[model samples]
Target: MGRYQCHLLCRWFFTQSLCSVIVQQRKTIDYSAKQNLLSYATESSLDHLGYMTDTPRLEAQSALTTFEFRLSTVLTGAYTIPAGTQITTGNNVIFQTDVLTEIPPGSLSGTVSGHALVPGVSGNGFLPGQINALITPLPYVASVSNLTESNSGADQEDDDNYAERIQLSPEKLSTAGPEDSYKYWTRTANQNIKDVNVYTPAAGTVEIRCLLKNGDIPSDELLEQIGNVLSATNIRPFTDHVIPKKPDKVDYDISIKYWISTDDKSRATLIQSEVNKALEEYKLWQRSVMGRDINPDEIISRFKNAGAKRLEITSPVFTVISEIQAARERNIECTYEGLEDG
Candidate 1:
């Protein structure tokens, strides 16, 4: 059965809205004078029916499967470091150098880079200067640092994400044109990919832009993997040229003012906290994918939802941009003026 129909059946059979009628009937029985066998039977039947209806729904839910996204880190060190040498951040996250960086014959050190040995959203999201040191020492390596921010660490895909992909699977599975095939392969390459856009500039030239889960650009390794997958004979058109690129990033600068009730002096702090949280959530929502327009009204609505009696959004004059450009919220600056008279 379809998931939606199964849910409907489960709700109809197990919900209190359905059982309440039987409960009302039981209450009307004149059990004050004598035992009501019919009422007891009705209650028992209701309980059994609820169990029967909910079991299949729960089983179907349990049977559903999901894919997980791989996590990665980028570690950099001096030259002449051997591959497979382990380094770590202070938090116990370990990484190994991928290639050996050899200096000239007499030189003391060289430079190399590596990634996290394990995957999953753990260590830290792409925070600069986060990876500090090595877990152990290597002979030729002098010092280590993060070349680029570590990112793309994600947990297993949740139900909503999985369902959305499942709905699109039919289109992807078809033997459509190169554009369709490009999208199919790119998305399947990494679960952390938030969205993919395909453009055909010429007869056999294809441009694929990818947006990652955290709104950051995809790493070189990720792009390489995507290129490999799309270049496969079965996945790509033999005559087409595929070029993968990252979306252009656009940062937003927002300033706002909120009017708070003067009667509650302590509310000033709460109001500021709420406004800050709302802005953070707005950034996440806005940057989650590419091609989203920046709307000042949406920002104002967030403040209203956060309990601001009155708000004025001062910046971001609502501009329309292309899908290839992604809006980002970095170093958000917010001003919480004093509380206003209610």
Candidate 2:
């Protein structure tokens, strides 16, 4: 009986000591977290560190579009369209004129620069004819409509992106037009840009390809914005020609068949859910970075870890992605071949 009691006491003491060691290790990890690395630093720590780099988090920007005001008939004199003329898309998004403009007596319409009243991405993607409803009425103004698609609306920068820019801030100081310098400045143009590829296509020509979040291609307006940033007198080298373009996208498909062991039949439903989620995560990981190779091995590993007993992935062979190209998924097909005996 005494031996059994001692055994119990020893187990209890060991458990308590292990717990204390774990607590101490955790405390040390928290205290010694790397503040300089983007992956290890907390958001608050990154914000505080950004001051040293002069990289403040990017704020949301209003969408810019052109608004055209039409007259029912040619007026006898030039009709002035005042600034602050409110126009709506018939939805919640509103746009207002940026400056005072006049429609000449012989002209049937006049166009003025305008921006969305609300900032951020919500005001973007309106079609050319979408903003047709005039909120602030003016005399003899027959109609108002946007002449171009709304664009340039961007959300505020997230913590990870802000941290990345802070890390890349040193590259912005280069005057000789290095690749990293172009990348650093291009990213500063908009918060929506996900990946940037910079290379010299010719001796004096610099080509920049940018990809947006979720592998969306950069719009013309965004490319223009990036061009403007890189073309600034201080940013661009006198001998270099900078051109911003879209990344060349390599397309691939995914088709997978998997089976679960019969012994684990009860957990088949749960494992199937996990497999689907893993597939989605894999797709995102594959396209999140520029020049990420399309590897079936990565898919196999993720699927197997997600409780897939055995799987066959047929479509995505190992393809090397070029530095100026991105991989985009075209189709996805996942099939469960039912349970197989172990």
Model 2: which residue pairs collide? none
In candidate 2, position 207 carries an lDDT of 94
For model 1 the TM-score comes to: 0.64
lDDT of 2 at 156: 85
Candidate 1 residue-wise lDDT, 1-342, digit = tens: 999999999888788676888887776665432322313323333334324433110111100011111112223532344566666667777766666555555444344556666655663353544554666565444455665566554555443344334444445544445465567568766667768888777888888888876576787657766788888877676777888887888877877767776775676787778878988888888887788999999988998888677877767769775777788775556776777786
**What is each predicted model's overall lDDT from 0 to 1?**
0.62, 0.88
Candidate 1: lDDT of 234? 70
TM-score for each model: 0.64, 0.78
Q: Candidate 2 on 138-239: residue-level lDDT in tens? A: 998999999889887888888878878888899999889988888889999988787888888789999999887777777776787789899998999999
| Candidate 1 backbone collisions, by pair | 78-110, 79-110, 79-111, 80-101
